[model samples]
Target: MRLALAAALVFAGIDHWLTPERYLPMMPDYLPWHLPLVLFTGTCEIAGALGLLLPRTRRLAAALLALYFVCVFPANLHNALNGLTVDGLPQEQWYYWLRLPFQPLIILWTLYAGGLLPRRATAVAAA
Candidate 1:
């Protein structure tokens, strides 16, 4: 799970750098310096992913990442609500709406895999 999350983050971060224009429409008009902010977020994503892989930084990375998910949510919501479109992405409104629920799941996955959350205990059958 941790590895998968890290891999996804790395891919996304690289994508941010490779095609930042894809992210511009998602930016809310109230925000300033969209390009720089996009680049900075990409940097943060890469850093957090790397940190998640290290034993020493996993918890902090997870916390920050969860927060990052929360911070970027408004952009996602805006995109969905306003029906914004980008190249190479789905044109279906349902696809964007479906993505909203996954944000919280990613946050939970990050926290759990980073060891910030307690593991679920399973009941053992008595012999």
Candidate 2:
């Protein structure tokens, strides 16, 4: 799982860098500085990938990453609603559908694998 998350983040970082204009449409037009937002997000993803590789800071790393995903959901929703197209990522239309559910699943898996959450077991009454 750690390997998977790290690999995904690294790849995603590269993708974001290569196609920042694509992300621009995702952000609100009112925002003045889109370039920083793009680079900042990319850097965070790379840092998150590195963070997930270690054991000591795993929980915080996963939490930060989870929050990151949650934050971008609105942009995805915007794309889906407007039927907008983004450069570099041609499949943006379908990506919204693919991206929505995976966020929670990723977060859940990260937390569960990190043992950050308490386990629940069913108890039975002895006769």
Candidate 3:
């Protein structure tokens, strides 16, 4: 799970640099330096992915990534609410709406995969 998440982040980070325009539509008009912000976020994602892989940095990385997710949520909302069809994404409105709920799950996944959250303890049978 951790590896998959790291790989996905790496791919997404690279995509941000390779095709930033797709992300531009998601940015709110009030935000300044959209291009630079997109690039910076890409860098953050890559760094966070790397951090997740390291034992010492896992917790911190997860926390930051979760925060990052929260920070970017407005963009997601703007995209969905405006019905903007970003390049390479499903053009269907339902797809955009469906994605919104997944953000929290992604945040939770980051925390769990990073070992920041305690796992469920199993009940041991008394002999």
Question: Which number leads on lDDT?
Answer: 1
Order of all candidates by lDDT, from best down to worst? Answer: 1, 3, 2
Model 3 quality (TM-score)? 0.96
Clashes of 1: 0
Question: Which has the greatest TM-score?
Answer: 3
If scored against the real structure, what TM-score would every candidate get?
Answer: 0.94, 0.78, 0.96
List the global CA lDDT of all models.
0.93, 0.77, 0.93
lDDT for model 1, please. Answer: 0.93
User: What's the CA error at residue 72 for candidate 1, in Å?
Assistant: 0.2
Off by over 4 Å in 1: 122-127
Candidate 3 lDDT tens digits, 1-117: 888999999899999999999898889999999999999889989999999999999999999999999999999999899988888989999999999999999999999989988
Candidates in order: C-alpha RMSD to true structure: 1.5, 3.6, 0.9
Top-down TM-score ranking = 3, 1, 2
Per-residue error at 115 for model 1, in Å?
A: 0.7
